[model samples]
Target: MYDCIEAIKQRKLKKIEGETFLVSEKHILKARNGDEYVGLKLKDKTGIIDAKIWNNLLHLKDRFEAGDFVKIKGESNYYNDNWQVIIKDLERLDEKEVDKSAFLPSTKRDINKLQEELLGLIDSVKHTGLKKVLEEVFLKDDFLERFSKAPAAKTMHHAYVGGLIEHTVSVGKIASELAKDYDGVDRDLLVSCALLHDIGKVYELDATTFNYTTEGKLIGHIIIGYTIVQNVIERLNVLSQEKKLNLLHCILAHHGEYEYGSPKKPKTREAVLINMIDMMDSRMQPVLDAKIDDSTGWSEMIKIIGKSIYAPKKAPKELL
Candidate 1:
């Protein structure tokens, strides 16, 4: 049996042998001297760690692909202030030889509770047409099951089993709470959009493998979700044209900006609210999940936020 990835500490040049990991990403790159090396992101339930194979790139290149389970012998080293493995040997493992559950990460929250909260949020929508459409889309097939299991993202916020529902419920609660304080805000529309914004991720990410599907990579979650919700709206013929467009717009613009992959910038109040809530949650999750550095009183640099976070070991007594 292999030890968990989290067992390796930062700055510790520890030796690891006969350990297995799921290759989440792989890259082949050239050094300044024109030598090639392999870069990888390896994961196994506890956490993910960066790794590199500095030599024999050509011989090891064909041994495995991203998403495959591989057995490795390596030594751990601190690079860029993060723990990483310098791989010496690697071999791909047969699926039958490994327990898939050991390699997949899962949410710590209760899946059933999150599912129930999401269903309650959907039921809270007073708009008859919107409620019917949601029911038709989520309750008709195996979608609810898949959605409950799907990760909200590949590596960003909520990238684990049951992550979709957890994020949806959290977003829904935030939207509803904020709607109550803001006059002229359509609470129903805002809440509905929050609950359904990332629904396409159910199909976009492979729930088990945690990799983007062909359609997910080509079309993306926003367009995929827009199409999914739009189809339901059209098929039911229950919503007014204006309401239908507003709902779809919220999903299309939740990414907030065009450069952020949102095809449409948020035009309506509800769209703007969803976009803000989505961005807030996505940014906060990584900081909240990171392990603080004991020496620097800071977190490793978060690529999404573009800086390291300060989380000192000792807090002010007053605050504590």
Candidate 2:
């Protein structure tokens, strides 16, 4: 049923009817003629498309919010080299009416296997107090369940089910390898902070919508993660004051710069390493996943990196 979205992109269909899509975002705007319109980012498992409702905005605007599943009638059109839908009619559907998974994008990797890798990384920690903190933070079933399912972000890289753990494991592996390469690096602290860095995203983003929660808009993931880690440290009271501060500092400064929402800048070697690795993973993901422009063999311009990624098609290998 949702496959038509792909067909729209492939130019196999020009109009859509009786199709249901998830509203990932919604915006109300005015045209030059001063008529209000509803703009939306619609998604199904196939992919996401932009949609606009230029008529009857007042009636349709309030019918659904971002994250609601909606049935829609629209025509597919291309403008500025992108495929989008011009919606004519729309109605919100109850949650029970649709398969939730049909609209949510998910990681291709085995989530269970990724969780196992995270647990394995935690097991490799040699610091007694840090190891305890990792176990207390991640080993709990409730937290594990949420962390395993939550997306890494709303629209940025790894923004899908199981994205948080996928990103975490990636950063953890990078930090682990870097620790081995660099002298005087605290592998325990670097790896621990890497795994814990974005843990707050589980709460920051709604489980189903992947939208920012009130707390996320106000406190953000860095501070939320810092507080979560701080509470665990206080309860345990096993780490030395120095280590505790350093651990929390790493979380608070992981974004690296104040302009980037980091409460503190990376002051220690471990914190610097965490920041770089985190940036590396975050920046690279979108480039890797970008939809390449067929004619240019380059990806659509990525706002985060301020450039398009060169991704020419590769010839298929001969199968023996």
Candidate with top lDDT is 2
The list of candidate 1 runs beyond 4 A from truth reads 1-3, 9-13, 316-320
Clashing pairs in 1: none
Which numbered prediction scores highest in TM-score against the true structure? 1
lDDT (C-alpha, whole model) for all candidates: 0.86, 0.87
